[model samples]
Target: MSAANAPTQSQLEKDIELIKLIRSRGLVPLITAEERPDVPRLSDVQGDVIYGFPKASLNHALNIEWFFFFRIADSGSFKAGLSNPDFKPTSSEDVKNNLLKIGKARQEAKLSGEEVKRVKLQQYQIAFSKTGLLVLGIQDGIADARFDQRCMRDDRVFLGDQGKWDDLFDKPGYNEKDGSAHDVNNPRALHGVFVIAGDDDKECADITEKLKGIFKSSIEIPENGIVQGHVRPERHLEHFGFRDGISQPAIRNLEYPLPGQNQVDPGVIVTGYKGDPVGSKRPDWAKNGAMLVFRKLEQSVVAWDNYMLDHGQDYKDVPGGKAGVNPELSQEDGAKLLAARLVGRWPSGAPIALKETSLKDDPKMGEDPKRNNNFDYSVYDVPGVSAQTPSDYYCPFTAHVRKTAPRNLDPYVARQYLESGSIIRAGITYGPEVTQKERDDKKDSEEEKFKRGLLFVCYASHLDSGFVRQTTGYGNNDFFPITGLVPNNHGQDPIIGGPPAKGSSGEERDANLDAKPAKPFANGDQLDIKLKVPGDTLNRYQVTGHVEIQPLTQAVIDFPFFVTSRGGEYFFVPSIPTLKTWGTAN
Candidate 1:
């Protein structure tokens, strides 16, 4: 690299300080950065520092993760339990330190040509709900209005929930049928959730039982001691048979990101840092902490499979299929292709942006880190494929992944939507694999014992700019990414978007897979959508020849809500030092 391109001496000093900060917090910098802003150490951040435990340090298999939800019965005892030196919550710093130790041991053993010793490992993290904070006398708000709301149940309107929330979301006596809160309005059902993760389920269970015993008097433990969740036997695939956790955001200073992974500022995921949406509005205790959104999303696997079987080939008619004629793909492959379009990726996690190779599930390309996430929406990254299909032709605008993260198209939208609104997801799939009988019947089992879904967990600096905005502004909104483009022809996100509320005025809950450039103007002409915002005219992209005008401008499809919200709660993951302060009475 030339001297001009090389990092400056000041940048090197900052990097050294960043490394020192991490080491001080018992963490090792896995990937070095040329230049990084001063960020909080992993020691102060709770939960998985690098988002979900996709893989363990040195390629160790991640086995299972558990969520232990409880209610604080006695504030004094609860505070005392938190203060107790014996009670140690999982810190990302310790997890990284363990990883570093394992890596070192492996390196030493390799040099000697001998076997390496197995290092025992476990991860633990703790977070409290708004009610949890209230029980501990934290009357001061955490600079997030959405986090401070009465409950997630009440905030469902913003998320477009159709009142299908699970009964567990309700308080002890609240009724689900008639929408009666009873006393639920007074106090939220759950106080907080304790996260325990490791390879050994037995060890995690034992630890959970021990903690329950310790905090028995302080909190009310559920009858089922731990809500166990595990990575599926099918590897990275979720219950619905789709690969998840594929496109996690890479924090600027925290991780060495892959080719096309979105890199965000530390303030996007953690508080009291540069670029935080709330800026200096946060309290001292909330520094290094993050706003956590937890949800129990139940997936109807059989129903989803049936939907795929019935409508998988629907996308064959979408305007820009290769060479303008559908490929001679099998019915099964066709269904799988449709599913890929809906998800914006194949079952193996290969993005549909590479529509040529992605016509069939490209396991080789999906698993390759260098290639899996290498393509932006605008630029087709596949070699030998020179098709310049723009205007949501190759990939739908409402596809789950595109709706969630509209890469390269950020310039057309509001400022900092990608940077400030992104979240660090650390969710785990819950429940057993689907039964053959359920599949045969084309529906989920009526029995509650056979229930399955995701224990969705994510962290961000501010709720409004992060989770809420992404869900409401992008996923749920019809005309998002392009305002006044063919009216409500563009649809809501099929996978994560909520259904329309009952008794509401005309709100079409469908997805438009094929959206061509509206007419009078041809392919190369600028899109005629209304531009009220500044900078909209600066980066207008000209359409390529591959964008064919379809017969119907509003080509809407009724994609059922295969994933339904069972219930959820918002929590605050406080810093380590702030947690220690809870032990002493104010």
Candidate 2:
């Protein structure tokens, strides 16, 4: 069913003219020999240039497609290095084994085949390297600081010469008024990051080929075009285990007919949501600007496993406390249930609690719009009884989705109606599947396991409003199951928050951490559910054994960040002032 009638992709040409007129304020598009395969390094305009989203109709659209990107800072030694023990890079066989284990459990529970993929992903995201990557800390501006001393820039900066250094990441934010946000605000700054990936070596080569051609050829767009990077993050499956990106918007108004779906109000991604002031209040150069934040967080499986061994029984997989002593649930089953609560869906993408761990894949029912988004958190809020026992029974308050956006439990009416899942994701996994040798040597030490983790990137309009604030403060609170009443309820998102330590929190005593963090639940569900769990139960487990992170100096990150940035920069993907002004004006 063609649910949408997207505009013919004849809009890319129009965007070119406007961009040529403004020509990115600070950052220069590093047209490498390969990227500029069609033309020489500095080719003159052919007849006319087009820009923006050729995929959509640009007629009379005020919003031009903005290109938000971070050039990799390091750009060296592009190796996956799975032999290293740092990330515990799971092998192809290991992935298959884990999948098999999850599949058997689902089958025994009677869940269908369709739900299996979801469970596989939960395991995958944790065990492997992440998709988008980022770097934090200090360095001189993005340009190589050592280059200046090496005399690479002596010709350009002091000797009044024409030559410059080959350094990357040393650029400024764009500003028309003062014309300075680049290297001038100066020195190494904390750089945000993102990237597209390949199906294999060949696919990446194919993308590189396409990109090289595009950067070289100057094409035309219809009106004012926008460029949205689309990727298939599915060597496994789509996010949350469904064929996502299908439900996303194509054209603002023409294609999308839903209410408030015309265009996300500017405030959605741009900063200054409700009362925040705009433009003038910002720096002279940042008038219509936005900053992106990116990070490469590695999930620790060993720690995560240890926590589950101690806490899995509360969910019916094991008995609470002392894994060796408890006779009820097997260690394996406990691991299974713990994984289910954190993801809100079983390995099969089935909401186990919704269906009581039947493990059947209900595609039509699972993917249905109203039903898909329809879980209510209110029933869990009540003190005495839950319409369904085990309030966080199916999903924990600390699960990824629940912590990010508390569906239905609208604390602030305004934010509730508006909250969308965290900013757009541009990611690619690094490192290979785990190997048998690494698995066997798992106990050797933290330094002997995996190479990398997810290189996660996010697009944000502002620092406080986007990535920085959430991961730091709001991202991991645990008060989700309790609903409307709890103190400082920004609970920990179990999937990303790292694991709660052994013998701490209800997850230790009860599989569900959904109960109010403030108000607790007791040991058993059938006999008596208590209003509060004692303070002794909730232990704070260590999130990660992070790799050494180099600091950022002079605004640009120093050479060696955890993600090991290669190269990247900020660019203004412009609107169509060309046909209206640039083309005619020139």
Candidate 3:
């Protein structure tokens, strides 16, 4: 498709991809710029941005938004049993205990295959202490102007492989094996806002701290301009349960992306869609700039669990007994399956309903860095292949990744993108891991039951198309049409759909039979699962019957929806140049 016709789905996909990078390394929540004014002023940035925000003007002050991930800050003091003094760190010898802790963390960190573990071992390497983060939600009105004036002209610091594309192509992963093109315009990528969060952890922290002070005490910005980084515990699991970052676009020439897409030209993610309705509205200052959407979406754990219980199936067995709902499934075998279907991937990060190449995680394949995320879903010897296409399966349609971009099933993945195309998301998990207080309260109040999730902060080329279009409609809305194999049966995503209520329509996901045991047919409120016989003669083709999806959008079927968004906000990350000019502009 031409740039003008670029789909909004592309932008949201990039945001997911970007955030996933942050999650894998535990290095997101990139800090940038110092705040000063009432409405903090920002330097003009390049490219399109997302989120609902205010316009920056000559008389305004700068607002510097900082990201504070819950995991990094949730101190042991908050919870009792889970993080007691003897949990691991408090009572041990400093270095000796730290080594053990590092070892344990390393084991868990291998979710990215081995690349993440092998990359480096400094706590501050990815998200440094001194590094300042400047997050923004480019207001819908001035997205074009802010992006142009700030993005392209800025130093483009903190971010990697951005300024250097050609050199990345010569790396080992770029030459062969994966056939997918690494287009810069892949829906999942970042285009605007140069990061000042340096390479070292200390530097990142130090700079970030200093910048925070600037936002708080500065005289130039507005009072409401800068939103201090504080832990918002009540709302979403994390700040706002954004499946913080997944599905980043692979920039053309950049070698060995974590996985997902290829690259393309910077322009694709820096302007409005080629034929976008808002393309003609851009101003001179917004030429190369992109939009940034900052959402504060909240998740209702209690409600989510209740929805699952009301509509989900019962666990026939746990390690010792049978338990089906959240708490019941917490440590049960079924718990793992429930969470897997919810996230569309095993906690190991493996997709449940979908598997790209094989069921197992391949070190050579999973850690290829480049080829890992580059595969597009090709039909399984036929057109409109549904069950585990070449790209990804073992998950559900509404799962986070697929819901955001919809993948190549559209054939448009290979086409030229619209100006307001790609998006690059980056966020961090926030809040405590299932707190006792919250869990206890959940038995009665859903508002108190949620576990920690991710604080979502994303950058996109266009606001309305990228972040706005996707979350609000593409993946956010339940009615988004799924142009799938069965046409009418193409349902919305089951795991991470954009439903109004967690599961207002009541849904259920069906997991085909696993090796150990299979969940029996369940009768839920609006969700019911009954095995179907595919061929002419009814009960013929059958395997290890498992559970998959019954989406909310297609209420007729029983797809249990897992992930949900509660609330969020919009802000802007000005270009470094924009930051410097903020106070002085007027």
Q: What is candidate 2's lDDT per residue for 1-586, written digit by digit as tens?
A: 0215222334223222222322211111221112122221111111001111111111111111122222223312111111112322122223222323433444434444443222212111010000111111112221211211221121112111111211433233422222233232233322221122222334334443443233222221212111122222333222222222111211211121222111233333333232122423432222222333333334344444455566666554211224433345566666656655665554433444354332233555343432433454435533564554324534555655455544444443334232422333333333333445545655212342353344344443433344433443344333333444433243455545433232233232323445465633332111222333457576544221222222242122111011122222232111111112222322
Query: In model 2, what is the error at residue 263, expressed in angstroms?
Result: 11
Model 2 residue 77 lDDT score: 18
Q: What is the lDDT of every predicted structure here?
A: 0.68, 0.30, 0.35
Cα RMSDs, all models: 11.7, 19.7, 20.7
Candidate 2 stretches greater than 4 Å from native: 1-200, 203-234, 237-267, 270-291, 302-311, 314-330, 352-371, 378-394, 411-422, 443-449, 478-482, 485-491, 498-586
Error of model 2, residue 535, in angstroms: 34
Expressed as tens digits, the lDDT of each residue in 1-586 for candidate 3 is 2346343666545434443443332112111122222211212222112211110110011112233321112112222212222222111012112232333344445564553232221111011110012112223344333222222111111111111221111122221112112222222122221122222335345544543343332212222222222233321123223222234554322112444553434334444333333546854334434444443333455545555555334534211134322354333344445444545443333434334332223434433334434545443543454534323333444555556655554542333432234566644443344556655666423443344444455665455556655654555444343444443443555544433344344333445633543554442112223455546565644322222334465555445443444333233333323333332332
Each candidate's TM vs. the true structure? 0.78, 0.43, 0.47
Off by over 4 Å in 1: 1-37, 49-59, 101-119, 172-188, 222-225, 322-327, 379-390, 483-488, 500-557
Residue 227 miss distance in model 1 (angstroms): 2.2
Best by lDDT: 1
By lDDT rank, best first, the candidates go 1, 3, 2
**Residue by residue across 302-356, what tens digits does model 1's lDDT show?**
8877888787666554445545445555667767877887888888778877656
